[model samples]
Target: MGSGFSVLLPVYDGDSPEFLERSFDSVTVDQTRPPSEVVIVQDGPVRPELTRMLARLVDRSDVPVVLVEIPVNGGLARALDLGLERCSHEIVARQDADDISVPERFAVQVPIVEGGADVVGSAIEEFVVEGDGGLVRVPPVGHEEIERYARFRSPFNHPSVVYRRSAVRAVGGYEELPLMEDYWLFARMIHAGAWAENVVEPLVLYRVGAGAYARRGGTRLLQSEVELQRRMWRAGMTSFWSFSRNVAVRGVYRVTPEPVRRRAYRAAVRRDAEREAHTDQHTDQPGTTDAGQD
Candidate 1:
């Protein structure tokens, strides 16, 4: 398989310039299998500091860096769709503007995509502070398991995925789905019969804190949850019963109090991490002990 790949990263005004620098360095300077090019999509007008940082990143980057600018602030889904068009390689790896990818992330995922998987993602380690203790969020490993898991929750970590550009474009790229854009696109890809898998190892350091949990709740997200469920049912990706169950369960989570939601989210992540650690002991899989949630 060709080692050439493009890293698609989207940044907005809300993103910290410091975090963006770390994220960019992780995918470019720190990767064991660095991307051939990096595409940074300016979702909207950013702070002056961010603009300067972007200029600096481009000036010092060893690989090609393509900057796609949007005059107005568009949401993540729209920004990603535009950025995907500028990607110059068949293979594309996603990187969040605030996350840190492990150096070997692409080294392991790229080969799986070349082996015929249309989409490949890995688990992530969610941390509030870099190098601090974090939980690893593990996803199901096999394609069949991933398909089954998608019926209830997201089957892949958005920022940790490496996929063929053709597969994503064939599925209609990313539609404007509020906060659930990644899940929506993945569901459509699955319905379109795209092969998918998730590496159990934690490959990215996902930053999570009070703000992250707070954003997960609220009326806007609840509305998006309902809309996403409706779209999934209309597309025949979920049965009527599944749709009803999801609307009831996920909807409640979206509207719950932020503190309650945060506790529940962390608890679930801890359980998954413990379960993965136990499984690793019995199997020969090479991975870390703690797991994270996404």
Candidate 2:
């Protein structure tokens, strides 16, 4: 409701305590402009270790955290829907349990979203299983490029995204799309004539591993892609050609050998030397030491 935004973070059993702390700190306390509040959704029953970690984080964090645990494992889309409904702010930022955000992530995005953008996301620094792994930067900046890029791939990083509360609600919140919930929501938002933009800089450290890749590269994904593209084509957000392109390209990636897929994945994202270089210049950068993160 105020100038500050609400961060929506959802987690499950597999998330580590290290990831939970860094992700929570990056959004709640370790930023130039911290959030007004945080709405963390427990998708379902998590491991006991994760429960203890959540308790420790909520107990230690200065920001107000509202925990909403569902009765059972409702999956990400339903969890996010509940979180979005509980948010009191007009602007909502998305934070993944295992990723880290730049200290200035909110400071940079709030102004642009306040200006006129319905959805504003930044490029991300993609790392592998280990936090210190190599980085990869994605392309397309500004609303125009984002719209263009959406035809082939997800233009904005999901964890690095912030959306106008009303804009997302008007589109019926997030849907239970197999592996493309974020991208599916983006397309629906665009089809509804929402204005979207992508900041050229990296704002979040995106974590990926075999698990993340496996989610996106299963045979089940073909059906997901088909359904998503059908919705896109029916909504007029994607053309027949674009629909075919998405299925073809994404299908190949899913069917490719694991090693080749990993290579391709690495090729799609870029090194975060830029974010690291800027860290030395900025005094307020977040120092997420590996200490106690485990």
lDDT winner: 1
Residues 29-61, model 2: lDDT tens digits: 789989989999998898888999999988988
- Report RMSD for candidate 1: 3.9
Per-residue C-alpha lDDT of model 1 across residues 1-294, encoded as one tens digit per residue = 466999999999989999999999999989888999999999989999999999999999998999999999989999999999999999999999999999999999999998899999999989998999487888776777688788888989899999999999998999998999999999999889999988988999999866888898999989999999999999999999999999999999998998899889888878866765665664554553322221
Question: In model 1, what is the error at residue 104, expressed in angstroms?
Answer: 0.5
User: In angstroms, what RMSD does candidate 2 have relative to the true structure?
Assistant: 8.2
Off by over 4 Å in 1: 274-294
Pairs clashing within candidate 1 = 135-291, 135-292, 136-291, 136-292, 137-292, 137-293
List RMSD in Å for every model shown.
3.9, 8.2
